[model samples]
Target: MVATVNEFDQTATNPGQRGPAEHQRREQILRAAGEHFRHYGYRKTTVADLAKAIGLSPAYIYKFFVSKQAIGEAVCALCLGERTGALRKIVEETASPVESIRKIYKSLALSGARLFFEDRKMHDIVTASFEERWGNLEAYNHDLIGIIRRVLIRGRELGEFERKTSLEEACRAIQHTMQSFFHPILLEQNLDHLEEDATAVANLVLRSLAP
Candidate 1:
């Protein structure tokens, strides 16, 4: 069976079985795998290669992660977490919901460009996750939409956004509209003028949300 996003999450898959020692070993493997992936790209890095790097056997590695793709998913989760974490911070700290949405667009465009353009090796993992439709990618997208939803809801509450639109519908629509700004492949194509283009898009989206 293919490994699910649950398997990639540190908290969900294992309860009693995942003690500190198990968690440490898993961290070790992930650290080594991340280093190798950053240097050599995910497709070129194998479980055996990770094992050698960390002085563990391939069998031992499998005890933690079921497959190489699982490792890739974990690493990709870390990368995605950084971006979402930034968005969450903006949601909490920004006073204006309208400004929050604007910052979200600019942040995604900037971060996406940095990850996909500067870190080509790590981008390989993201590409694979997208191509394979990994569960973790689905989870990431859900979390992203939830963040957007929070901003939209706050806007409505503060009399900044149209009250007639359905909350869920508005959230999904905004996320879909901004997909190219964050989607790895599509963002890559727009990197040359991403910041400018993203600002224009953000303005358009904000105008649509205005009460």
Candidate 2:
């Protein structure tokens, strides 16, 4: 019996019943906390604020997450996870490696840029994470680079791309060229032409890798 996300009431899934239900409630709390953080900013939003949004008490929030910073890390992970997870689907589902590459870069650039643009407060969480050095930003970058490298390997396997250098070297080049599209601060400066800029850079990337 799979429980739908809508049905997991945190109150019902208490501490004593430790199982999938509890896990679902934790996800709900993270999402609620994310929304709160988006609106109120990290420094301004407290666990009590998240508790209210999740329809639970601050004490209950502790049952799932140790501290507010923990919740922030969870939220960050969820956001990056969703983006990275989609890369595989884009690569496998698309017939053309070039098209897949284009889609991946454009989706990542636009979505990430739009997210921070819409929720300006969320950027503050990123800043806080860097200042504290408690976050796994480096790991996130490495994972993303791995995904791109796999996609490139697939393209090579299909004879759609010609790699002049090693996979590591190519991945580094792509990421370096597209760094502005990935970084929040760098992206914000060129927001007025992000899609066009992303498409242009993506095309250049493909040409650089052409056989």
Measured by TM-score, the strongest candidate is 1
Steric clash pairs (candidate 2): none
| Candidate 1 C-alpha lDDT tens digits along 1-211 | 2333333334464221222335788888878888999998887888888899999997667666667887888788888889999999999999999899889999999999888868988877887888797656877898899999899889999999998988888888889888888888888788888999889989999999989
Per-residue lDDT tens digits for candidate 2, residues 160-186, read: 899667889899888888777767667
lDDT of 2 at 168: 90
Number of clashing residue pairs, candidate 1: 0
Candidates' TM-scores? 0.89, 0.76
Question: Candidate 2: worst 10 consecutive residues by lDDT?
Answer: 10-19
| Deviation (Å) of 61 in candidate 1 | 1.1
lDDT of 1 at 166: 84
